[model samples]
Target: MQSPPATAPVAAPPERGTSPRRAAPRLVGWLAAAWLGPLLAYALGVAGVLPVVVLGLTAALLRGGRTLLDRLVLAGALLLGAACAAGLLFSAWPWGLHPVPVAGTALTVLLGVAAATGRRPRLPRPVPADLLPVAAALVAAGALAWPYLRAGDLAGRLAYAMTGEDNSRHLATVEGIRAVGGYLFADPSAAARIAPEGMVWYPQGFHLTAALLDGFLRSSTAPAGPASTLDHYLGWSLGAWGLLVLAVTWAANRLAGPRLDLPRAAALTGALTAACLGSELARFVVYGYPGESLGLAATVLLVALACRPVARTGTQLAVVGALCVAVGFAYLMFLPVVAVLVLAWLVRDRRRLRRRPAVLAVVALLTAVLAPLPAVAGLLRTDQVDNVATGGGVFPRYDAFLALAGLVAAGLFAGGLRLPVWRRYAGALAAALAFAGGFLVYFRALGTDPRYYYGKTLHLLLAVLLVGAGAVTLLLPAPGRAAQSRPRAARPHDRAAESRPRAARPHDRAAESRPRAARLRWRTPRPARALAAAAVVLACAGLAGLPRGTGIFAQPFDGRTMTWAAAWWSGTQARPGPAELAVRALAQAPAEAGVVTVVVSDRRREGYLATLFVATLQGTHGASGPAVYRLPLSEPARSAALVERVPGRIRFVAADPAAAGIVEALLAAHPDLAGRVTLQRLR
Candidate 1:
């Protein structure tokens, strides 16, 4: 079962490259193997969205005719992309149009079409060796997730044990989508009276998918949690992130190539996993950036899809495009990473790439480039420029880590010049430039947010390590017919052995002692390669623990951090967090369904719940955005027209003067409701 080594001047025999006819079987096999871990982990987490991912992969297989590895990586990308795209499309519909049922319906239609095409792929039989890599990834993923999978319901882990303001906000978004049936582009709470005129198009891949999964789990026959919102948030986090470990391992496999014997592949897998499980990922989890984390993993798979040999078919190109769209939907901020890889791959095969997949690559780049402009990037919703701080700090604390990584990446590029797989390092070089450029230009122009660059460079660092692994695998000699099959002609001295003097004889001991030009550098031995792989894993594993343990920031997760974690939506409000308070406040609102406005002037950000989801959640109307949480209702008419839009019986949920001002504004706006407005205080 030995195959040709990936490196060296040896070319694979014509028969070795699997033809299009064999593609269907391999494609099916690859998809099964690649998705095995994710399927097992997310079996129930996202049953609703699963068919969408599967159907998308099926569509990609229909476009077949690639090697097993290519099909495997490409299928993963297509599956992820399909699910996200479906979620985005459905999220645009009304609340009744939940992504789960909508995507399921679409999947059914796509599958029927696929069946009719007669190009249906068969799942390939995976060998024991193939299962090893899958096991490795799943194991690594389980290790990283050990802390989160504690004994208890998800709400306990997420509510009291969780940290960060984003997760709750993400939950709010998911609930909002679930409530609205689609991304109405307005606040989710605007269902009551009138949501603001602002049309939101935020990518709903992560949020919508999570919502679908949460709904699936809730309706399941398992024990129920205390509240459905926490369950939904937990489902979203796991649905997007549960497969991260497998995704990274698959990317490492793509970078290493299938020609690797089990040992080398295993070694590369370790190094790749080490590089991938960085501290930033932990921070993303703890900090609550589900979208960013999901994007990071998706883009890794995207790179694997894009880095294929030219001769790519239209179907393959379509799969790549779908994956790219998903990556965009998940985290437009990291779109450039995938775009750059596609461009780099195209440049490498200037001959074939120029004709094939070139249009696909261009379209991908255009999608990424146009995402920032409000005119066409509306699909991104709140991720637009309006979401960024117009003014704030310049350099985030992580800049130091990014800079250090840049230098190391540069040194790697410089030092690994002679390796056969040096070209693979293009990903690293491009990512480095992108990272530096974003820091110097984009963040500076848009104001620095800690979360902006935090998850961006994780893939970049892993990319650098994968490139290094490629170089090692290529430079190291592999004993195969292709690698050493070609025998060199006899040397001149050997042909004229009888004519040589006694001292010049080939067998002379002095000849062995003499220096020779061919021995300039010692070829990296197999043991050394194994050692290097081990070292890479150890270092990366140590760093991987950094964010969760004592990271570069060394910021201990003190009581304040716990408060932030438990705070979820409320940062540092009252005991149970602001989301709890806001939900409680809304629960107390008049059940008659009048406009019930909730306000939080402090950093709690709890008020967005009122503006976003409280309306749909509580069966009332909420007409305030998070910004208005701090808005002083000094001018009655202005305040009334601005936030407190209810004509009568405005339910005020803040104790500050701003809350008072809103009541005054409500009274002034609707003179008939002078005594209807009421205030409630939360302890």
Candidate 2:
């Protein structure tokens, strides 16, 4: 974390509003990456989520010295990118080829190669600063997550969900991974049940991580049974939402520059929070799209990295290329957006990048090596893409307003162009323009309801706009200083100032005046200037509200969203339902009991969702009932008769009290299930 040695000794302190040499405040980066990295590795290891930790460490070995957030982001991208590529590579293997061993072997080779490069990973230990901004961002994100976390237990936490269809299909996809031992596509029989079209080329980035997390939970947690299955999906879904907010806040802070004061921290936190709450993207969680949520977070993080200066080294570019590949894995649709940012990064550093053609070639090579090529090619063939592209609907209600607001925000970025530090912000500016331009093109060329899929891009654009809001705090002088200090007359453009790096530019008192075109002279009151800056920050936050959705504020309101969780929770209701009975009975099973499949015989429709829950919990991969149908059959004796034929896989029969006795009697005479088959009766 040592700052590069000062080129020349300077008497004056660094300029207040200028960009920093490093992406983040030194102390904050140290706490985020250096201290947290080992703890994360240890936690993942104990939880049996080993592949992610191994892959992350491998990427870390390649290079380090970026800001704390930047380093962690690169590591995360590599972990996900490796899993994704490995999943696709071995995706066609037989059912017995488990994801763990396959992923472990692949990562081992990569780890060895990274080690052979002899580049030790070393994080920079930048100078210390208060962690106020980081702390504020965390607190704000926790508040946004109140709906999921407010519930006392896993079942209770899952009650806040809005859609069961997407949840079930996604959980089925996760279970599909566990069932086949690799990607779901390798076993179409298992994969076909998860999605209508069969998940042959569906992005597994979100599902890969979820499957790993579910494995950890399955290994560690006591048998809460079916409820635990729901817990895994719900937990990851909520986490994806929280991650989005935190990523945006981090980007905002990074863009605001290194030295953070109290006001700047507060501004960054407020602006990001308000912007997220007001945007349509906040609804991704309730809408049951955690994959898209996680994808967007990766998308934002990728852009943030592009905004920073990258050294012209093969290893660094390779790391960046892996990040691009990770974005595709997280969500394919956002890859185009990330591609634009990557191009901007190269364009901004064209001088250095052009000098080493081999480095650019290395980046392309690494990206291809890590990409899910077959899946990328499959994007065009999927009916889902066709529906999104050619589907019906007009432009979004707020499209025009958002477009104007985005342009207004671009003006803030425009002001940075005058400074030599503009290179650092060029990517963000390009992203905002990309979003606006993409929106227009989609509306004209694609489906009528372009908003259905393309609307999510607005969230990324909004994040960039809000970063501009946070940077305002860094640009304005403190009220205290403004009040006491008088601005000196405008001095001629100094050759010395032009020669120095943006961060090293000394705060010269004699030359402390606005540019020659100044309307506001140095004689203008400093307190008023400070107040004006604060107003601008507030104004930016308010502007975010211009594109507000109907449920903009409802997302964070506990009282309003808590009601949505009731249907998913099985405990303490006036009348215990079929799903409740099945989950409760499953919960009674011993933790040591090896995977047990139960045929659900609830006459009610609740059995459909309960079947998915049971399928996930039993590790049967959607093959749980005596006969797999959309809903469980009501006749227990008939199901028992079918179970008698397949005693090897069907371990238990969950039936209502009225039919449990008949089923139990039918199974009693069977030699294979004489004592093995247990009837879980729901009265």
Candidate 3:
């Protein structure tokens, strides 16, 4: 095994001014590598290949060499780009119906064509040191997931630890897509109450991929019954978190590179991973925001890509655009945050922008044209905008603390100004701050609570700020430089040194001749620099300790947790509930039963539970529009009338003691209703 160098070597830059004929081969190589990695991995029964492929292909496209960290950062842009592109295309006929199979065949064909016409992609060789960050990320993921995994029973393990109500809605939407074999627009009826009338568009990237995985898993496992909604939700949400942690650690290491040795790289990765896992952002999972989780992962990757210079090739740029599209589909709100980063990137790389004036003009025009697109067609309906706009603060007390922290981070970022690389950190910090400021001002202008929606940006801001502060490690002298600065006594075996140039360069002589006091301007005092490095290390340690200190880590364990709110529905092992049994029987219901309607007596309390499971288990289990309709069963006649009005041959009615008698009486009153209805009595 070869020892890794002080700085990981990178691939040779793509040749400048290459002819189209030559570029074509590399472009093909890029696509083939990108597509084939995920496609093959999925075929091989690998779970979580989406992020891995995005990360790998990004490395291949950016022509990021053997340095592991570079690919992680660049992966952000590629993940969104590639997923969006593929997802949109998958929404097309035939492909949407059989996404996994179609994706495999299409990617295989593309790979074959590229192999026949283009040069093989010269992928970076992984080093032993590369595994360090990956291991750290895995540890962080495992730690975060410990609460759910700690359950003694299978049902408990599959239960989503987070209490967020959004999980039920999201799962229902995913179930709708899976049932329809395409985007919700393809068959709005399948979406049940999840898709309200006139809500024209919803980003389906996250749901689409989850649905595909659901299909893939069902086909592969040959399960005796319908797959668990809780299982799918848990896997997807936690998987996104894992990818985010991996990206954070990799980007943090890359941002503090050149002087970082193998041990330092490992330490930095571990510390950053811990801080990221401990940060307030981890609560997103607690809130059951799976779409936001995936989108945020892509957002971090995009930021990392922007922290560096622009992509070298148009193919790489196209890949980035695809990622943007994917991000929009995954979570529309994050796109504005992405746009802020792109603007900062453009400003930072003005020279590149200047050279490509046409590209710059096109970007500006697109920005102007596309900025208002969300308002026109986003998930938030016109009526809902005020509800969102008028929302109260998420955490009012933390405002002053966060603001102070931001200023301190900005000050620390400024401390690294001597190095040209500091500009990268500056660009990232500026983008984050600009995003925060812009959102805060907008909310204030609307005269609403500032922190409600604005709170979403906290994780992104904290991640960037910590990474920027971590760059303070650069203030410490490089190992080789430190060695050179030390006074060395001449030795008899120093022949190799004398063979080298003995003449001191003018700048070197001037530096040596300067008084120590005068040299203070150019050179930081060693003790002061060491102290600064120590302080940064302590600050990061403090951040990593937050979850434990604040007891945030124990939240999932302590909270009113559920698996799509089905834990209460499923009941304990000693007392299994009717959900699974009911779904099984419903699957075998006669055609005369027609389209099934699930009526849960308590719609406001447990309606979503019925909706989510019915959609997952039976596929498109809603009555006409909503998955399950709630009626005031307390009024027997009115409730019976409403149930009779449900346009379906078969109805699965779940009602408690109070409502069961009414349902039974309704059945008795109408022999036709008794034939059509299957009532499950709740305890």
Candidate 4:
């Protein structure tokens, strides 16, 4: 295979010429490739034509004598086409019986290995100076927007976890493990029966971390409940925010070309796309569902690490192990995807592997061993084996539109089809196939009313596709040189003497050199600026009406609200001591005299939990027993009625005494209780 020489800057088309538009046929062809490529591949696989299609594409490309990059791209496109064809062709066949495509994939891997044998060029390493700020902005966006979107039912979930409901379950398992003093796996059947909803299917690693954190916090502060409410927010924030940063940064780096520019815009757009795709996953976290978030986060990290071209052996092993653990914990379907990625990586760098095959082998072994731990535990302890088998019949419909849109978005953003690297092509192809297969599996697992499954899977696939596309688009093209006022096709003899090649022969000489900074400064004149403005306006209009007429801030209490709430909560109770003590004092009060009415401005459950923790710590019977009326100041008559009915039973009402009518009403309604009420300012 003849590799293409290092890319030389191409002269820009003359300014007077009209810009070339994609031919209508070419547009249709590309659209068809996007939409029907998988389907055609699946059909061929079913008809036993996969081999023919692969060989034909490969032969055709080879015959064309295209550059090595083109050949590599063609190879990947063929493999992807084959996988999709096989999927469709064997749609009715069981996964096990579909052998042709599997064999074809194996053959593709072998070819990839053979092709990578020669000397490979090294790309520049990405610098933190270029990456960190973009990453930070993406993380900030997630943090800022998370709180508002996390309110209502979502807040209740976090509140439940914070109060220790979810953590308590995990802790019980952990305590059991500690009691046994080894890796004492719980009974899967019993575990499943009592396992917190949404977590029953997940592995233990992620939950184990949460449990450990809860234990430490409890030991230190002895919060009233089994879990800390803060744990929910912290867990969600960390997992979601972390994934967003990693994914968006990866995408931005891919899009920003070797030098990062104002990558914030691309990062933000990519983040939004990812958020939309993973919205359900986000909701799962807010509802105190850590299992899904944990699994999803693990998957994201695993994919990110796998995407790295050069990694330490140890890092690769660690990533493999983590991925295995994540798959074991989250979903079994992930195993095949992980397998394909690792195999592809190995194929791409077989020479490196020959030097240290043991590392890869060890990673494979650990992955196999550790990944099944949770599944084994389930098998031994319960009927999960049968459950998994029975559940196999459930299949969700794959949203063709979303998948197409995601592919287009990914293509546009990452320039996946445009990249010259074989590894990049392989990675993109693998991702697309994995997504399609995973969706098929997911659909199968949904059984009935697969629409919900479609919704969930559509978001996930779109995120993956868009991120992939965006990264590809950014990295493929090198920066353009600054435009000069020179006339087109000027005679080489008229050019400056220094601009001429020093070498005697054309092939032996390098192109005219320009500083990287100078090259980056090149801007297309007036027409380009006008086009960019038009594009921006169109983009803004499109965003304003995205998801079928929804506004940009259409979702209720989106990221903005969540961020504000989280910030406010963080600021008000920077330390939990005062709030903890206050709740304890209230909890110590007598119950029959009625409850301790703690009036707080925020209606979130975290606030109530904080109040309850303080009351419980103070040895207040009302805090633990009953009659604990933790009313929001927003509710007036209810607060008044509780005080009126309880009278002397109301020992203390915690409130911001300086507040307006609500405080005045409380003071007037229960003057005796008001004297006993402690005015504690969070600040």
Candidate 5:
């Protein structure tokens, strides 16, 4: 709950309002600021609900005279919680879960009933000064996010969101959601029911986004294909990630305690964004881990919300409960993350918080812990795998950026030891880093083949360290001598002195006659100097360690991480290659509610073609439920005896020409498939 410093320096009043000639840049600036909200909505796929939720929060925020940090916390938590909860609820309703409906109805009733009981909404106080810096940051964040898409596939290219590491599953899951299309989360829930781990029950807000976006594209005149997916991503998801970075930056700096001014807060954001790409988590994006991205954003948001003054009212409890369900439904790990935040919050202010809002705080904590019970139960039902501890590589290969980032962050922290940040947040910062280390140790101790566990900690550690550094750097000493204190001759009224006939004030003629540069040599203004340094820091913070090479920012998406992905746990197993895209001929062939036995004889890629076949079929419309049987193509791969044992009621065959001939010879020999089997040759 550390508050960011208030917008520190107010702008000096201008002599007059701007004229029309200078208005275009200001308009463009406002337009950029306007894009921030939609960027987050598109990223989370809450466009349908986000605007409404934003209106509600805005109304409440104005009534309460909320700070920009507080407003963002409220808006982010409220929107994410509502959208994800609705998704989970609709998806779960088919299984007879009343969580969403019950909660929604109860909340609606409470809103009305409590209207008469709660305090009347207040008229908001106008505070333009406080809002200006926040406005600038919003536009700045949008500006930073803008360039990433300019270099994307939007111009002309064929691709799916196949760039990220786990995007195969992530993108497939999104299509799977569409493939099982129904009322909102209901279809998504059905998907979850089929394969909770792979497709269904994970954090699905991003999927919901996909659903919303894809549904729109489906209805539009836009071309349909993988290239369309690229368009959607470039137009939306890419910018959304940028917005997420900005939102997290705001939350992190705000969490550092409220004295953070806009420039420093922005510095912290830049620093944090730079580290995000370099962190082990970058692997998730490189690998296409959709859930991890959403979960991480939620974690930052939950932490941000913990800073909101804890309240004990039916309405507060209801909202918190909704958010808990959303977090669990979106990504269950975040429940624990929020739980830790709750524990930390309670622990930090135990003496002070014990008095008034104790019961309410407990309610909030219990809500967070218990909200994900259904998901936890589902996870428990799955068989567990215990991996014996084997160590992982330190700093990881190809992540030299991580090493550079760590050095920079450490230096920043160390360099600022003389600053006040150490006095207030040194312990909290240490605790966060320690907690991150502890996570690594605990997981590495369990040695459960860490997919993303250790790296998540690195992300957290980097962000915390950057916030500490930014706070110190931004908290520069107050301007010296010449006085933000209004020194004599340079006062606002001093301009009026020119009209007075004070005999040219000694050397005024010489000063006026001097070269423009020479006359102003000693002016050395503090504001420009401070702001110029801050601007350079901001640029470096935003651009440093970003993904480099041909990408929009520094990070190139799919190609850079392919090397690491090849070594990933699932890289070798049933991993699809180019064959999936090559096998479109079969999609046009007749299919039934049965299994497809694929025999791919491309010796250059053996098991890889089979993997492609399975993933491609799973992605086929109305085939999400299909059972895939992989048959490696060889003389021995086809067995006439095995043809009779195929389990599907209606069988289909899809294979390369040689494999098709092999399958045809086998079927000719046995004739067991009868009319129930269909065979289509793949190109």
Candidate 6:
């Protein structure tokens, strides 16, 4: 029999430390670093030092003698520390501030420890080729799972776009780019008119993309009224979304390598994608919610770049770090998270720190380069401060307790593997308590309807659980080395080697025969198990309640009335005709003629038709100097009185061609102004 391929050599354990294993100091220090770090950073504006303190403590506990695992941990820590320092510097530096004193102090201690123990370590091996296929499968699974996971949010976004109410602002942005040749920043006046008055709260990156598309589309088309192209908008939105997914998948694959098997990778990617698509972050990309996604993506990429091998030069590292910090300025949530994650890395990877001083320097340079623009913008704009403060109303103070508890639970569960089963159970119980406490605190603090908060909490919890489950599943034990090398079937000699007594031979035979029966029993139960699963799924579906009607599934193109109107407009190559002409004629009329009254069938002055009329008049003749009044012909006497108020000016009555006959009847009843009024079709 062949021996199992020699198991990859496990790294030798580090030598035992002489110091007593006292839990109190270590636990207290960890809690302080985790809880107090952010507060200190916020207050002092020096965020990089806390992580160094944490790293020093961790190193002291772990460093009796170096092992390969210790070295790897040290490398990871250095990378993290460097990222934190870089982010803080970049975030604050543009204001002409330096975080260098804090960073320098941290670094001096780290280097001193490294110099005393003086040992250089090599980088880990490149990702294995065999793992590529597993990564591809994982990414594919995530993409496939995305739509199902995000059905509700996707449906809502589509509905919002189809309504053509607030959507017009999105359309106008696209149109303005085509017509005026610049984004909103370039032509503030034009943009201000087209965009909703308070839309600055929305993220600018997605809208900026829309503007770019408009410019591209406009080069081919003539000057038009509004951008009504649905296909174009959908294509651009989805394309950007697809790119985000691809980028995240690539990053995950790079970070985790073959250790992240297909199923685990898929679960992680799917959860992340679902979170992005369904959370407030998606609102940033979809409804132009504003800078959150840009900041998040930037922060993640910066960490990834910082974690890259040290063969790269300081200039290259600085460029990557700068971009990260620049993008982070777009949203504030990323800053603290980025800081914590990086600090965590630094504590975990000390040895790498000594070898790559240049990494720290590059991070500092990048942070210096990228942090100022937003800080300056924030200082100049009081409204920005008000908006940020208003958003804080949703953040409940108690949620911090919950978050802290959850973090502690996760850490304990991960590190407590060597404990007894009851201890493991206790760790799990602690985690659950933390989660519950956090969830309830957040729920009450947000002050929204409980149902809505519950939904949000459910989604957040699901994402957390999915990631946790995936990580655990991926790390579960595989076959032991000896078992892996064994033959599929037992030989007679193997049975003889057991040296069983003759009397026990029959029992052995009976046990051997039982294996077949067990196999058969397993096969027999599968169908029942499947049926039970199907029944449970059906019951859950029934409890959830299905949405009623074709309306739920309806797409934008399903609105036949709107489709017909669009088709007619496109088919006619229609220029605005009589209504527009009448507006121009009225504007050109002498001041004594008074305001022109253009009577249309609708009561609402800002319906789709009314908006079109207003846009056309503006496009053709600039807002007609004489106010054009819209009087609804549905009320004939009132319409007549309004027309009489503007007697000498052209009294143009326009109605949908289909509604003209009804209008004519009303006109026939009113003889006094009938001769003066001109009826026109608005087909």
Q: Rank the candidates by TM-score, best first.
A: 3, 2, 1, 5, 4, 6
Q: Distance (Å) between predicted and true CA of 653, model 5?
A: 7.0
| Sort by lDDT, top down from the best | 3, 2, 1, 5, 4, 6
Comparison by lDDT, 1 against 5, better one = 1
Model 2 C-alpha lDDT per residue in residues 435-544, reported as the tens digit of each score:
75677687777434455555566655655555555445434442243222322211111223434564554232222354433422334464654465476556654554
Model 3: lDDT to the true structure = 0.52
For residues 470-576, what per-residue lDDT tens digits would candidate 4 score against the true structure?
Answer: 34333323324422222222211111122334442111011125455644464556466445545653554344333333333223233332321232233321323
Against the true structure, candidate 2 reaches a TM-score of 0.65
Alpha-carbon lDDT of model 2: 0.52
Which candidate tops TM-score? 3
Candidate 1: 10-residue stretch with minimal lDDT: 487-496
lDDT of 3 by residue, 1-683 (tens): 44333122323433345577887786677666556665565567763454444345445544432344444445445544444445545656664635345445444544554344343334444554578667866775676566566655433443433245455456656666665566766566655543333322666667777776666654432222344666676677777677677767665655554445454555566556655655565665655677777777676666655654433433334344555665666766777777777666666667745765675566455434433343345534445355456545654325423643565455445445443345666766777778777888888797766756687666567667656544644544333333244323211111122333544211122334656554334344556555554555456545444423432221222354222112222222111233433343345432222555554443343333443444444444443333244444335544565665665554555556655665677778777776556676533
Q: What ranges in model 6 sit over 4 Å off?
A: 1-203, 209-230, 247-258, 263-295, 299-323, 329-333, 342-363, 388-469, 478-683
Query: Can you write out model 5's per-residue Cα lDDT over 159-201, one digit (the tens) per residue?
Result: 2233332444555556555545422234544444222243443
lDDT of each: 0.48, 0.52, 0.52, 0.39, 0.43, 0.37
Model 3 RMSD in Å is 8.7
Q: What is the per-residue lDDT of model 6 for residues 532-578, given as tens digits with 9 covering 90 to 100?
A: 44454343223212111111111132343211122222222122333
lDDT of 1: 0.48
Q: Ten-residue segment with the worst summed lDDT in candidate 2?
A: 486-495
- Candidate 5, residue 154: the lDDT equals 30
Error of 3 at 301 (Å): 2.0
**Model 6 Cα RMSD, 1 decimal:** 18.5
Model 6: per-residue Cα lDDT at residue 60 = 41
